[model samples]
Target: MIAGISVAVAVLAGCGPLPELDGDPTAGKDGGAKSDSETGRGVNPLDNPDGTGPGLKVISSDKDRAKARDLIDKVATKGRGAKTGYDRDEFGYAWADSVDDVPWGRNGCDTRNDLLKRDGRDIKYRSGSNCVIASMTLYDPYTGKTIDWTKSKASEVQIDHVMPLSYDWQMGASRWSESKRKQIANDPLNLIPVDGSTNGSKSDSGPATWLPPRRDIRCSYAVRFAQVALKYDLPVTSADKAAMLEQCA
Candidate 1:
């Protein structure tokens, strides 16, 4: 990852786009931390402020995604060491499946509120609800930018599965106990709130085939991707491993 200071320099040098500052200047960065403008919350990090010249762009293709998914499934079945399946619990279904039924949960996690809490700036719990996150600021780690958390624009930022669940589906997860599957689905280590456009572009892609548009982030992204795959015992395409090694080195 780029040092926080280097990120600030990227923004100042017009290397990247300036993030939208949508919350109180007093509120801190990263959604929950206390804010101070002097600490660089409102800064831009791109080498090009105008967003010209090789800005971040995710590759797109349904065909490639399908191939990736198939590759994951094949490797997962042939590979050993992954949890065979998710363990079921008293809830009568997998953790991920149960959360789907929760009134407030969305997208595999108690997603709506989980993200609200994770992304909101001066977030408040919805009235009388501990499970609900009322509001908070969103700091997009992918681009080193911040955004306001108004309901209208909420979709602009989404909680991305750093290692996509679909990718898991084809991998060892297909054989996982539903309960274990749920844990991976909801695990904080597997999630991040990033720009919707970026997340869509990344859909189910691995390190070798895809990466964040922010050039400064390749190292950290590679590290995180490796850690997650290793943790879950997920299989990686040879290209994926190579991509991660190249970036991390």
Candidate 2:
């Protein structure tokens, strides 16, 4: 009887194993991409679409989703059989540099810029700076709103965790190693750039409570949520499972 949308806990658990501050964070796989171009509308055009190309094939089947739901149920109740140690009360959380004691790179490609470059078409660098992207063109599938990804205006669009980090932390990520956390933070399986307003409205929430306002992308969003959680071994709350069954089915 896991209560609340609580998708954030699931999201944190999934990416928790990825070392948050890798020597080359951008070197890891990217999440947004497309399997094929159907009238130039079906491609996500990033790096990796949650370990697969962005297409109908990317969508999980009932069997895969059911497996994911089962895993979630196992760990969703917290206490006793919690999946990861990071979820324990004694577990301490810290930012990458402090926890790992690794020097940060000046020109390090961050997830934000990497995503901007990947999702933004004809992207422009903000300056001569290494990965400071300045502008891009975004085709919003959710509300049919077209946005220009510009340094000044692009904050309007934000990179959202299809599954949120905070939620995942509670599910089973609080006990992971530092390097693993970095990897979790940078994994392409858990991120998507969406409308800033929409993202804010959906902050750290899951299908049961917060979903994309635009009905068009709800199915896509649900599939992605399942994929990332399944990839990272995160658990889903009961409410989350029900929402996916109703919306993604």
Each model's RMSD to truth, in Å?
Answer: 12.8, 12.2
- Candidate 1 — worst ten consecutive residues by lDDT sum? 45-54
lDDT of 2 by residue, 54-153 (tens): 2222223566445444434343332222334343223223112222322231236666666555455566775677678888666444333446767888
Writing each residue's lDDT as its tens digit, candidate 1 over 85-116 gives 42324223322324432223454446545645
- TM-score, cand. 2: 0.62
Query: In model 2, how large is the Cα lDDT of residue 242?
Result: 66
Give lDDT per model, in order: 0.50, 0.51
Off by over 4 Å in 2: 1-107
For model 1 the TM-score comes to 0.57
